[model samples]
Target chain A: MAGIIMEIVQKGWPISRIKKFIYLGFLLVAAIFTVLYIVKTNPINYVSDKLPFTLGNEKPRFLFSIYGSGMNGGLSKPMDVTFVNDRIYITDTGNKRVQIFDRSGNSVGLFGKAGNKAGEFKFPYGITGDSEGLIYVSDMRNANISVFDRAGSFVKILADNKQLNKPGGLYISENRLYVSDIAESKVKVFDLNGKKLLEIGKAGRGKEELNSPNSVSVEGNRVYISDSGNDRVQVFDTEGKYINTLGFENNSKTSMFVNPRGIGVSGGRVFVASKVTSYVFALDQNGQKIFTLGGMGQEDENLALPNGMFIDEEGRIYIVDSANQRLVVYQN
Target chain B: MKLTRLSLILTLSLALVMAISTAAFAAQAIDSGPVKGDGRSDYAATPKNTTTTYPGGIYLEYDANGVAKDIHSNYQRNTDACASCHATHTAVGASLLQWANVTDTCNACHDGTITTTYDVVYGDFANGTRTYGGLFGGTTEGPNSLSKHNVGEVNIAAAPGGNSAGKADGFGSEWGKSFECSSCHTPHGQGRNFRILHPDVNGLATINRVKGETLTSPDNLVFSSLKAPWLYGRPYNSSNFSDSTHTAVYVNGVKQLTGFSIDYKTGKVTFTSPPTGTVTAWYVPSFKVTGDVANKLTANEKVTYKEGFNEFCGACHTDYAALTRGDGKRLTGVYQEAYRHAFGFNYSSGPNKKGLVFSNNAAKSMTNEFTCMTCHVAHGADQTWWTDWKTKSGWEGIVSGENAGSSALKRLPNMATCESCHEKGKGDYTY
Candidate 1:
């Protein structure tokens, strides 16, 4: 290449012409760089690569993936999911109802819809059951949390008005119900009855401030709130005493919760579902991470927007694979 | 000077000898395909190398077509325990560490890889100075500048520039600005299908913005690669102006002296000015272009100056002529006067008479370049900008002027520099 270039130069090209050629060369290089950069940004709809499902370094196994018909044809935006007695209850958010299925993926029953009346749900996003088989759903748009019996009977509504603006996630611990409110940016505590207890943290990015507080899960006397806007998790005691903060970084990967709408703390672990990364990170007792699971795919195991997660006493992991429109169960 | 026939013969002979010896030593031939579990040869860099063995090493074996033949890393294999080493850490620094000092732990094995005899060439190896290798290759620095891992100088504890404030506090010499063996090249072996450090280091495979390109998207836009947010001729004022640090200021035409970083909570911009010049309005740069004038960017746009609707400093530095003529040469004030940082210019809203501001002052604690890497780490198979062979740990070389930020910026160590520019809302805290 150098010899060929030397021969061309030996032909005695004019300096002006040579300078023009250099400018042309630069223009060509710039054109190439621009084209490369433009081609890099392919718009949405062109689905990116479906990264392999990896929990830490483990290939998410198929403990069992049951495929059976459902009552609503197929799940649509299954917002939040919970597991109890081999039964999986999912908050079909877009369907405006709750669908119950067994471990075998067989539909057991369905309840709730877009209504302000009792027993009905409007934008249901959170699901959790109590020891007495009492189901609690975060009726987000209604700004109230409704309770129903295992038989799908309306039990009660424990919140109303600005107090529970867009209640997204619910967890029952020590007879106290913790409700994660998105708009209000605080977790409204209440008793089994419709009586409000104490409100914790206003909306802001501080140790105590909650920004877009989406989900809550209580372990012992501690409640963990996903401070979505702050890109961190705020931990507080049952009495509203701020304990500590977790996942404090602006990076996309190291983030524990970015728009995290649902949380489940069980077996001394906290599972945070990040709406941005679409991964469920498991944290230990001290909020130390055990592992991060899930990826972006529509397949049964892959998560799209995992809004809610539930861990059974048996250590089985269940996720409401929201955008994928289905329920995913990860059994040990 | 032209080479004589004899000289050419001698050069050719030397080149041939060097190429032959380099090729022979480079190819530490191994069994075809990726290494196997516990297979010590598995740790040896293979041709189409895949599968590395480490505690919780996420392994993925891909065929020539790039389809995943197998994925035993991340979560499949029991060894996929990232939390084992990179535990749930939430300090103000880099989390995810089993032991403290990352370099000390990595050196236990890499120090043995380097072989030196009578004299040390790279650095003071005996005094604990050493170098590392590139991604995939066994040797430290390869012959070609491109082929080499480009790991920069490693500053050990004895070294002056040790990262004392790093995640590993006083544990040992921290991996400084320079790249190390484990920087991009995870010592535990690359389990990522795309070869990132963590699961989403670079980005997920499915996160494509265009066809064929796996790891490219708008979210991947690094601040360093793009033009700076040019806030051209916008109203700006601050409440915290004092006559101390900010000794000189000019609003529209009046001459004043005041400098203060805004604190939104108190609605004040704290600047120390001399006890003279009165506080006046200033023009802050726009954070994002809302109109065609602010956003109309084109190709080969000169970095220095341009005519209409461009981000050249010359646009506002009309005073550039006046200043240069008054003095004999260049002045740095060209940036401070024409360019601004804290004032609001984003589409959200600009600072008003209330003395509000939007700057990264809220996060004054952070360091490091706040460009793309501030929020994005390259080589993360799941969360980085793109995949390049050069992305092995710490091998990130100097940026080409074309690829640099508005000021031909080099990367900083922390996220503070970013806040110096991208802070949101008046004052430090947005609360």
Candidate 2:
């Protein structure tokens, strides 16, 4: 191949013309590097492989998955995931812990364990990292909310929360923490000090009521929940008003969402992670189906029993591809 | 300190390798399937309501593509225990119970006033956590009724964080009902327990058996499994209480602080919180559930005791779940061995203990492991939560008289309850 290239160069143009072409090639490479720098998240370890599930417009592009390859950080059944201050906090639940990562998919740090202590977590469920550099995790078995500083040092738990029953999904917005009480079927809003400011929803079959809600997310004043029991993502205002229902298929009874567990809201879209169906469903702000992200499989981008999800400021989606025991990232 | 240094060296090496690999594979554009979503602005809501035999009835609750739910097949096919409480043919009420309301349907079999076949007075529905007895299977009316749960016929409101459950004006009642059997018991059933309680850890659908999924086993934290209530026929029911330590600690935003280490020979933690801070108790990350002292329970057995039953009850009565009930970050709270006191296999009478325990053991069989039945009845009874015979403090229950309530002697409702197997302690006693 090198001899042929030399012959083609001799027959095609002079040495000076060839030098000009080489210069243009160098400029192209430089421009590509500049574009990468302009975009904050370019995926540290990128594999040029095709991801199965993506929207038709090629909006969501699959990035390198962080399944702890070489020394890239391993995860075991990570549940909920959150992004704050350019860091990813995942409830690396199977390890009875939490795993933190930087935007470039580097292992930043980790904390928690399997115990009934202040810093320990017995099955950490929903995890949220706030702008204040505080990380809050909902212990499913402990039935409490444990707060930790950015370094994962033990901060206080939510104060005297007799109302937090089977606390599952968590979110931090407007300096308040929103916790989904799986048993009580309500979203509890708490102040930064962990005092519950108010609650949203009741237990019923109504549109406004929730039955065993798991993950709760907030966009503006609207709160979205993976109403796992109801088999749909129920949207509501922060004040507990029923806004609309997302993922409502033609079959109103058993539509698209089989077991919606984790949810995320950003960039005019909603992403739902369901357990039984094992699909990360992307829906528009109006509760319309945008695209389904994954299916039940062991392949790359195919998710099995996905738990939690986080969308970065640049529209990059980080999924706790839970049962697959890996953290998957995608871009649009 | 040695292990910390080793880990630091290892981490740094790993980081260096990762950085090199990252540099090689850097700047690749994401390539995959089509761009997502239906961009249509107009959408219609066409409700698909199918016709079934039972009018206005929601039979086959929350069916997942005809997937057989876990609780549905927990028992044998012939043993249709659901018929014991609900009757589809001779229905008498909305929920199809034998009686018009839950308060009456439960009282008919519980109050001991109905028929001799099922004689037991659980007291009024509106009664709180206080107990009542002298009927069928409870503490007698005299002293045993010290502190019974109140489930009387009064208007019950939603508990804190409670939705419209068991409220008089909630699901089934408009004029307001009283203390109800449905308030605590999920009669439809979720587990082996007769009255399905709240926070049934087994109620969720586990990823271990999702349809068409390759994950044949459950991972810790059950990320793949989905948690639902009995109302949805939940399937994913498992905990993260594994035998492996797998504990990771971070302080001051760093993984494994530099100033802490564990002496392997002594199994003790040595820590000096540097300016960056350090983790506490990561040396013994978890209690060893294997070993002669731990009864050599298998992984499944260990989970039921260590993480299951306590969490089930903690769903509602959150305060009684933990040993210390400490809510402070500064304090260290430890969970006790729930089985040794309740349904576990280590409840033999201790030496130097009260004679009441000995006599009760002699009269009845105290060989059974601890369970909710060991100390309290399934329904409501006359025993307070903390008034049980053992100490409340964690790691302090082995020796008696350590805390204020450790030595208090209490009895279950039926004379045959705790008194049937455990005698009252005169002074300080151990279980």
Candidate 3:
């Protein structure tokens, strides 16, 4: 209620008659605002004051993060990290290698050096090791998905189907591999032997279309895709039929996402990592948002430009904080 | 005493000469407007002037000596329109924009429907507000409306072999970011124009940037000379084709539009033609704002409507703004709007649809002319233009392989981007 006029009056500088009139006007305005504020009881909200740790339904503690020691565990703009069996495979994208780690965050070894050869990589981005420990690394620059065996040995380059272009995100399940190419703006499905099965969608804003799809995750008969360019997360059937969406449109006091790029499924929860908003949105399997987490900051709990992530059996979430050049872990 | 008298006489004579020259210069600057010689005389044109151009909503304040200063030119004064949208302390988001970004802030007012306009509700501009109204008559900015400009920034850096070094840092520090309102508008009152177009900040001002820089900008895409009008603002067809005759026809399609052989930076135009053996491109420069006599700005007004709108946009899209074809070698001496995309066309009398088609220049100036906002959204438009393909059923589907690469696909029904408004059917687009 008391604004600039009140401050002027408190200063007590009776500079002129106009100042007196202004003070009187301020007092009248203040009285009106005071009554209005009482009636409304609506408090003004400050955005920066919102805590990073205060988002989402399930509060996950900021467990120790791995910034990489520039040795065995070194990372340069790591894109995605996935946990298979007892080992973790991280797409060290900028370094052009996949760094394997243990559940305790210690480095096991790394595979696939930087090159354009069959066993090598060109800007390796997404990494997902299947249940059989058959590792799949999508080379964004090379436009090919390379498969590796359980011991970090190169199995073969996916040449049976040469349709990959700017392969950014990958998700594999039921002997099928799903590749989301950012540049091509589509999700491609292929068999474990690298034969083309079905192409999912193309660049568009429509229900069946996608734009700059960054990550794809599968659970049962449903596949959740991060429609980054469209600012929403779309759900598709295992056969790639369009099934509703969950994102900025469904945003409310409970859940919302902006540039939802990294998508992961754990149990029945769908976790969305938004690069621009720097928030990880958590939703139920039915596309209903449960809680939200993280805010734009460099703090322990805060996330900056989270790209790819995975959830372990124990409900621990590992986020590839791309811009921060670190792997952040959060456990409920 | 004799020597003193001589010195006095000499001084009086010099003073008289100086006074006469100063008066002549001022007259040359003020009198020769469009009213005098088709907006190209000792002055340039009428519309290019700020006094009548800025109309009412300009942000300017005069000093004690009556010199006008743009409000946002100095932040310490706090006189500009910054607080109109942006709040420094209580702001959120990466840009510290009033809301999330320019799109949200602009949509607050221009969304057309105004139960709660920013000027009326949240802003200090307690006056009437203008709407950036959706081309299709929506109240909200409708960024998500049909197909709107994409303002969201992607975290991916520009890869190698891309068409550009990279797009400007649109969102925050990251280059290749998507649209920001700042990409076009300065937000704060700046330059000599009201739109706050940053590259061509120096509008018709003559003290500096006289003949507008002809070379391309350091950014490599835009040309600097695009800041001001070198010829008249209206369309002049300079083709080998013909239509109606002119008052005096020099070229077939074009009239004797006397912009050739003038220097707008120097505020001079020539009516003289080449001699029997003279070799000259006959490039005369005139302007719309400087040519107006009655609207001579009193130091505090913004440039008028359609004055430098094309030139300002041409600052970024240099090739589109070229008056010449073949790499600046040929002098078409006009904007050449026949085969290429057109801007500044008079559309006051056409089918006045709001968005999907030609409508009233709703958010544009009162001149009823079409500028960049007519077809494009400032923040960014839908990427459907880049990805949509025609299916065998004539509907949109995910195009693949050879068709996407080798074949030209038909446009299908989508949100109101260029296609929805252009036309329907294969190659039958009216637009």
Candidate 4:
């Protein structure tokens, strides 16, 4: 190749002509890159129409909504909802009661009332259920968790003010209950019998720390917490070991969360209800963005300060739209 | 020659790519449904994606159209703060509050779960940690004495100075209505008054004034056609102008500082010389302070009182409020010694040289006028010592009968609130 270039130089080729040829080659390569860049950065190409059920692109089908109080099946600031034994148990916070309903949007039977008695609730914020049809509620104002039987009867109370201060969200899995103490900014794990097992996180914006965590969900050996005030999600092992952090806007490719409240892990996706933005963000197990549900509005599709979320075995999402005073159901 | 042809081909390809990329950028600008899952659509709409951060780490995000998506405690337009107190669809109370009553709704956040700054029930730093509003429903004052304001009481009796026959407004008619938190504070944060105090309390409009005025004079010196009476010596408006300060005068959009003298009561402006351009004045119609002024002041700081507070209190207590110097001399129709104590007087340089508790120390000097808040607490008075003394046998001359040591929201209990400044019965008492 060097000998041929030397022979061509010896031949009568002009210097300006060689320079022109080199410039043409550079221009051709630049044009090809520009075409590729446009196609890569195009917004339409980011989400494909062909993949309809993709995490971020799929739209949830509205199932039904339950609202109102007493005979009208009404609720006042219903904070949390859970599915158990084919029935829905809602912590009717404003009325200071636990309202129960059937799957078809019918009021089944209700329990609890406004007081500090064995069954009453001051501010029931989070709710969860177990396989044997037992329900657990996080009474925020009373700073305790109230347990009730499947028949809407008072069973007992767990984790009073001594163990919890402003307990907000609850999750029950594998005979272990995970409770997020909002004031203390800690996640306390307890057995079904109200025995403290493991404690996770402290009040800070660090990696192993949480700031006003709202909800907790257990998927296998991992525990997912909505670190609300920090605007992120912290994942920990069942033994309370910090695994990873997600949803901080400062992290590249992550969406901004303002006061994330409710969280649920279902179908390999983690769903978080952002309180101030009124949107539910879905993320994959690896903390990659999947999709978002609803925005801030009064419409059927919109949500207002959604507090608690529940995902049943059937892949149906029950959102406690607290500010809207209703429970909105969506099919995944 | 071949190189030149190749160069032309390369240039054409570059132009083609540029054209297609421009079209693609424009096509991407289309709105893609509602939910912003991928962050692409959200980023496209809000290119900068700016956020306005408030106290307590509360922040609001503006949408693509530059409208605030959700507002928390800031209480600006299109606020989600409404949902904080009221549940629109499942309202359990009269004003769409999810709770059974207005006080319950206020107590929900004020109980210190959400914020300890405005804990009204336990009086935690609500007014700079002084418990200025007093405790609600507690045994601070003996076991039997409830001395606080009956906030949630239904069908209550008339106010002490309430006159239903004297004023035609709803102030007089509010006698039997359920006295609640909404009676004083407008929850939606609508009023220009301090602490979101309702501009129109009961039926009386406490603060009234022309917002903006263009002054015109034949000789270009005096302009006096103000539609309403302006608040004197109180900088309630944005311009912060009172009689002591000049009304915000603008000559052709430039602020004029020295050329005008304003008559606050008459709503008149007189200029020093003939002005060539158009003269305009911007002033608030009533003595309305920006909301939450007291929250910004320190505990020991004194708030300067000028005017308008008497009118604000007089809206409900019409017979007791002395609107003017002449009105202070008589007890309405009876013409006896003034039944009500004098207000709106500058007590800064009086026999009582010590300054009293004022409204806010934002601007202006401490005039120390005898506003209603000077001798009273807005919520309730919890003085256990005074309640114990009044219930005993020896305090008959000072206070007696069923109303004995009721406190009536008095600041210092018994006549000590009066004696602290007046020094008639005892020597000058300190706060």
Candidate 5:
């Protein structure tokens, strides 16, 4: 075997040396590739990319969602939706009531009827819940905000100032309740009782102002409001500090929104429903679109005149498909 | 700049290569700083740092500074021994010791019998290797001698005692997950706790078991069930009356040991200056309020409570309290003494007998009976005891180092400390 191998090598074949050189070449190339890969895929780069989508930017566009709409017996023409214990409570405007449904779309209960009474509603719009599960509803047309127990019993009428003119939206946290009156283009804060504490956002077409503000959301100290007339979402603090504007168009060249309405916040993402373009866009707090669930047009996800919207804990979108005569749900 | 970068890289690479290859060329144990006597330090305790040299070459190396270096011995009592086979820096498994794989880091070097005249082999430690010699004494049948570690058997049911719910003889059950070096041995100097505090096991159970924001009925009920025993009034003594029932509650048969006031409402078990040596009882915080709520407990309190009760103890042991207490109710809140061991078995009765029987209702306290810690280490143990709980010393009491021969004394300082009272087993248990 040695003689045969020597004969082959004598024919000028450097097999062992060539194999060793190839192995060395492979190791060198693999090392270089691994270093390059590590440098390119550094986690710092991912973090930097994600930074722009938070409260770091000027125009922080939030996502929009719709909850319950009329045409279904349980809820019709939902003007507002709030979530509690994996359940969504919709202010069913057309049914003149508030409807509750499990996260799975099963109807649980309903409150109110077509009446002008205290517990009853003419057009209920904004709805919210507190830590104790007490729900507060804005009876928009009736010009009063009503509070209800978790079991839907009418607790009391809260913050019924006639100054709550055309109250478009309502939001409540553990401490305060915010009421947005579209006609006044102002958000009014009040105690649980009918006591006005502070009023925010005056009617204005300029930046850092509200133009027919329709919806309100409060997460910690930051307050987000939808400016329908200006086609933007404005940020403010409880002290009414104008933090920033979300989805504000610098130029008309880029179609931002025709009529931005209805706002909801969940899992660090914000939802905004646009009536004019009939699209719902999801944005981080900094107003960058993470993904668009639906838009205007004849597609499976397309919404016809998507109006009021809300989001649940699981990041599912509930949209008021007003033109479609259905309550549509977009699941993550 | 480019040349400087290249030089620095080259220098680091060369230094690492040298440090890995030749211990003599290792950088000065300087940053380790002149050896201190503690295990963590590199200083030599010997004068002149020189012992009599052996005929064979001493396995010693010098750092790059040329300071004569002392070889590192297995400082950790739980770590496997080097020099059993290979030279220094040549052991295969983690911690630079002789283990075959990540799982064998503890068992590979200790994979065989360490039995001599005094120390006895218990259970098996190797494949097809059953316990050969007797345990403590070769009096009865020797324990199952098989290597329970490095088991690549994918099926948990296939391993010895794998299907047996309470049997923890050797590495009998599937490790379920392969033992990565990080799994049991934190090479980065993690604590000598079980499996190097894997991210999943470190505090996940506590974090996930936090109490809900809204205390639901079922959750609060479970929390209350764990607290009820502490809230129940202990036997109180009244010297003013001198009842025999109250006399038993004395600290030393003179001073009253109960009821200046027992406030279940305050949830604190504090002992005032009213008496000395009086044992005040408190529930383990986790048992009362879930791990999350337990964090909210006040520091002024005492009397730590625990999770397992007499029934949890009765599940495996042949204690009369456990059997009689168990009326087929699984999460039973009551602890009836009369029927304690009626459900389990009595193993100490006959010769090599193995069957569930009524408890003897022995004089010892139920807590003194077989507890969970008796056989199983609740927190993770060394990979050897972890892999083979039955066979290893320091496990179930017998360990290496300061205490070797007797299970009565353990080397790991805190052997079966939690288990001496929390023993859990019945029937003449064999690996």
Candidate 6:
């Protein structure tokens, strides 16, 4: 190689000309290398158009999402949601208030603030409402349940800390309110007058036991409890007897129920929010999964660490996308 | 013909250079694939919707592929847990936290509903065990009790050990101007440091974990390659190595403490004689605990304090921490007082008193070191027992009022922590 370069230099080529030719070759290689680096590391190459699930094709199609900061008619780490009188109520946990929104995902108003007063909440984890335009909120940090009028007035307090410790997920049905005592891992049933009716489940992993029960939903003679720590939902008769379990056997990588936080029952189907996976599962009464919705993402269809879920009579599912600070509404 | 030959050689060289450069850049740019247990392949490409119109701009750490990094314990690589505290597009707080403040974000799950295992508000785990760090709120001591860290206190104050001049390690400037949970603890896992403490706290000092070493010795004489000069012991989930101790040797899952001796400086474990069966020396490595390893740790897993805690805290409390002997008494311009508690020494070197609570029960021998956590709880103390003493002696009025008893954040009430070890005049209480 050296002899060939020397021969080229001697054949009608001066030393300076030969040097210029080599320098030009080096410059050409440098320019090519720079172009390749730019193309390889371009941000556009990393952008993916693929999504986890196709939108509008799923069983429960996502409609839209309502989001904002607490001051701007939005939510802050909203934990639970309830619908009554054509209005959506969200427990805006971060702001220590409950935000009210219209059925079309428009902000109506908000109530409660950060205080221990009758109209205030330290941390509201779960919420529910009755047909009489009355709203019930589980004040998690205060360890009590507070009731409010439809217009968002503080009416009274129900179920003191003595009966409940770290209360979560409120469900009202048939003139009775079911509260999940998260600290005690028991679901306490109370009448409309705040009288203790029946206490269900103990703190254990056994058949009738619950560990960190988050939500409770009652449909006719049946009740569903989201046994969160156990990663399963336990169903029981209205009389507080164990009926069956759901989503426990589906403990696979793709479909397992991990830290199931929110639950709703409607149209002979059970809707559950798996908190860690950020997926909402619609299961039949027989515990077979029909379809799963909402993997973790910031999109309208995606849910990030969803909590309380409410399936209205019309089968419209309202999920409190907690981490996303939004309420995602889905309908069949 | 000669010019054509030269051009050919140059072209070949350019092709080789391009191939090498492309390979190097691709290695750095390629995504390592989906994290284990993450089902979705599109997770890496999830775009962070940060807009100038949004208040408190998003502050999430993302990889080159725009995948949000996991920044919590329990599930190290579980990106799904990221949504539990962060809001990718609609973040209300700095750092993309779902809540407006750090305290509220932490309390979302630590408030007992999600998991009672870490109910910081109540200061107790699910098993009713008091956490080393005391409560942020909800103390049963009294209605007017001030027994908490005041995690989100509006009026921030300078830390006790803070120094305007700088930190002891000569790194930080103006230590303890502001304080939050992340000031001391890194939400993202910190190598193998206990409790995910930050590697550098407020620029006071850098806390580096000791690199671990593993050795298989046919003869139980010498095992080397341990990196760190100081062998810090950490509790393992396995029953055989449940105890937290330095340089442990195992034979068939049984710890061989009696037969082995370790040289701390040289990082060598010397056994008395050759033992039968497979012999292995295991030390905790300084690496991030992945999801696989974190899943194995039980909810009530013990956290044994290793070295570097004094420097971690001293980064903020500049004068309070004593990293060496007699340093607590060595007063400086910050605080001219020789009378302060000495720490960062092994318990056996001092009194070696009985009845003193060791951080870990299994390793309650001379190896247990006396540090800040020895007498003080990290967050705050709920010592109601001091009430009786304060009332009877009229000390409540002399001090800062009714809440004065709870100010120090001590583990025991009314100097009981000091009495437990010193036994001053209480001989009967000595075990």
Q: Which runs of model 5 end up more than 4 angstroms from their true locations?
A: A1-74, A161-163, A249-255, A266-268, A297-300, B1-431
Query: Which residue pairs show collisions in model 6?
Result: B161-B317, B161-B318, B162-B318
Q: At residue B357, give the lDDT of candidate 5.
A: 13
Per residue, candidate 6 scores C-alpha lDDT tens digits across A1-332 of 55655455445455478788779989997887778576543222122112322222136657888895345666777899999989989898878888888889778788888777676787888899986989999987678999999878999998787787879998988788999988789999999889999999998877899988999998767899999877688999989999988874344322257678889865555788988777887776667666677876678777777889998766688998887789999874
| Candidate 4 chain B, poorest ten consecutive residues by summed lDDT | B63-72
Predicted candidate 2 versus true structure: per-residue lDDT over A1-332, tens digit per residue: 44534444344445465567669889997887787666532332121112333333234668867774345447765778888767788887656788777888788788877666777775688888776788888886567998888878888887433756668888887788898887677889998887778988887656777766878888667888887666678888877778888766543443466557777754556788765556677776556566677755557867756778877666778888765678888885
Highest-DockQ candidate: 6
Top lDDT prediction, candidate number: 6
Cα lDDT tens digits, model 1, B1-431, are: 12234335444666798899888545423212221232111122223333533322233333222112211222321122232235344322253443333432232112221111100112112122221111211112112111222233432221212233333332222323334334434433333211223221111111211111111222222222121211111122333554222222343345433444332112223446422333332222121111111111112111111111111111122222212222323332322333222211122332221111122312233222112222222211110111221232332332212222222111222332343244443576645
Best by TM-score: 6
**How big a share of the true inter-chain contacts is recovered in candidate 6?**
0.17
Second chain TM-score, each model: 0.20, 0.32, 0.32, 0.52, 0.23, 0.50
Docking class of 4: incorrect
C-alpha positional error of residue B321 in candidate 2 after TM-score superposition, expressed in Å: 36
In model 5, the Cα lDDT at residue B201 comes to: 22
Position A279, candidate 1: lDDT: 66
Q: Per-residue lDDT tens digits of candidate 5, residues A1-332?
A: 44533443344335575456559979997987788576543333334334644322122222333344334464444556777756778776666778887767667777777665778776577788876788888865566888899879998987564656657677776468888876577889887766788888886767666766777887657888887656678899888988887763332222245456677665456777765455566567566554444443334565655556666545566676654435677643
| CAPRI verdict (incorrect, acceptable, medium, high) for model 6 | incorrect
Ranked by DockQ, the better of candidates 2 and 4 is 4
After TM-score superposition, what is the CA distance of residue B6 in candidate 1 from its true location, in Å?
98
**Residue A119 C-alpha lDDT in model 1:** 64
Q: Candidate 4, which segments miss by more than 4 Å at Cα? A: A1-56, A68-73, A249-255, A286-289, B1-279, B285-431
**Model 1 misplaced stretches (Cα beyond 4 Å):** A1-69, A84-86, A249-256, B1-431
Better of 3 and 4 by lDDT: 4
Classified by CAPRI criteria, candidate 2 counts as: incorrect
Off by over 4 Å in 3: A1-56, A72-74, A159-161, A248-255, B1-431
